[model samples]
Target: MNFESDRIWLYAGEDTITNRGVLVKVKEVLKPRRLRFGWFSKTGWSWLFGSIIGVFLEDFIEGIIKETWLVIVVGIAFGLIFVVWVFWAMNIQTKRYSLIILKRRHEQESFWKRNKDKIIVALIASLISGILGVGGTLLIQLLTKM
Candidate 1:
C-alpha cells in the first residue's frame, strides 16, 4: 500500500459505509491484525526527520521569546534567525532522507526497527534541548535582575 500521495486518506471503523478515502474490511475471524497509516517508507522517514527538527526549533523559539523581555530588537533578530535556520535545516533533512530512502528498500516493520535507535536518540536530544532552553532562559532572567 503506497500512501505517498496527498490525496491519500485513511479510515478504520466498524461501520462499513463511510465516505472516507479507502475502506478496508476486517473480519472478526482475524484476531491480530495491525492497521497502519502513512507508512510509505520515504514519506515516513521524511516526516520523522521533520518532526524531530520541529521539536528543537520550537524549543529555540521559546527560549528567544523568553529573552524578548530584555530586548525587543534582539528577540526579533533571533526569531528571524530561527525562521531561516528552520528552512535551511528542513531542506537539508529532506535531501538527506531522500538519499537514504533511495539506497534501501525494506519492509515497513524492518525499516522502523532499523531506525528505532536513531528515533530514540532524536527524542532524547529534543527533550534535553527543551529543558536546556527553558532552564537557560530562567537562569539568564534571574541573573539579569541581579
Candidate 2:
C-alpha cells in the first residue's frame, strides 16, 4: 500500500514459524457504485423487478379505477413493496461483498488510495516551519547583539 503501483500486490497471511506470506493478485478492483450490473447480475434484479411490477400495476390501476384517492392508496402500497425488495437485494449484496473483502485480509483503511498530494503538502509544511524557526532564532540573535 505504501508502495506506488497501478496494480498493488496483496499479501495474505504469514506463518510465524516460516515467516512466509502468500502474494495474492487482485483480479479486478472496483468502486462499489462503479461495479457493473450486467444483464446477468443479481445485484439489481430486485430493482428491475420492482420497476416492471410498477409498470404493470400502474396500467392495471388506470384500467380498473378512475378515482384519484384509490390510485394514490394503491401507489403507496406498491411503493412499500418496492422498498422491501430493494432492501432485500442490497442486504444480499452487502453480505456477499463483505465476505469476499474480509477474505482478502485487508483493513478498511487499506483501500484508501495513495496520492502524492498528501506527501507533498506535508513536506512543504514541515520545510516552511523549519525555515521559520531558524529565521526567528537568527532574528533574536541579531536583536540581542544590537
Candidate 3:
C-alpha cells in the first residue's frame, strides 16, 4: 500500500451567515476570492442525517412495498404532508426567530433591540432571585447562631 500527500494553498472563502470577508493567504491575494459551500452550512445536521438515511431510504421503502402505483401514491401523500407541515411550521418557527426581518424594507433587526422590554424584565427577575437567595442564606445563618 502506498500513501500520497498533496500540497494545498489556502484560499479565501466568504462567510455564509454574516456575509463578511474572508482571510486571504499571501499567495491568494492576486487571485479572485472563491466561495465554497456558500449556501449550505458545513457539518450541519441535515448533511449528517442525509448521509445516514436519505440516499437509500426511498429505494429501501419501495423494495418493502413492492408496488409501483402504491409507491407513487405514497410519495405524493408524503410530499403533500411535508408541504402542509412546513407551511404550518413556518408560522410557529418564524415567531420564535431571534432576529426579525422586515420584508418590505429588507432589513434585519437584532433581537436585543426589538425585545428591550423583555430584556429589562429578565434582568429584574434575576436581580430579585439573587437578592432573595442572599437574604435567605443570611436568615438561615442568623437562626443557626441563636
The candidate that wins on TM-score is 3
Question: Each model's RMSD to truth, in Å?
Answer: 16.3, 18.2, 19.5
Candidate 1: misplaced stretches above 4 Å?
A: 1-111
Clash number for each model: 0, 0, 0
What is the model-wide C-alpha lDDT for candidate 1? 0.53
lDDT of 2 by residue, 1-146 (tens): 32211223444465443433222222333323233432323645666876777687866577457667766676767778777766755654554342235343364444335556787888999999999999999999999999
lDDT of 3 at 63: 52
TM-score of each: 0.30, 0.28, 0.31
For model 3, the local distance difference test gives 0.52
**lDDT to native, each model:** 0.53, 0.57, 0.52
Superposition TM-score, candidate 3 onto the true structure: 0.31
Give the winner by TM-score: 1 or 3.
Answer: 3
Alpha-carbon shift of residue 110 in model 3 (angstroms): 1.5
Rate residue 84 of model 1 by lDDT. 69
Range of the 10 consecutive residues with the lowest summed lDDT in candidate 2: 1-10
lDDT of 3 by residue, 7-64 (tens): 2244335556433233333224423322233233223533554554556467647855
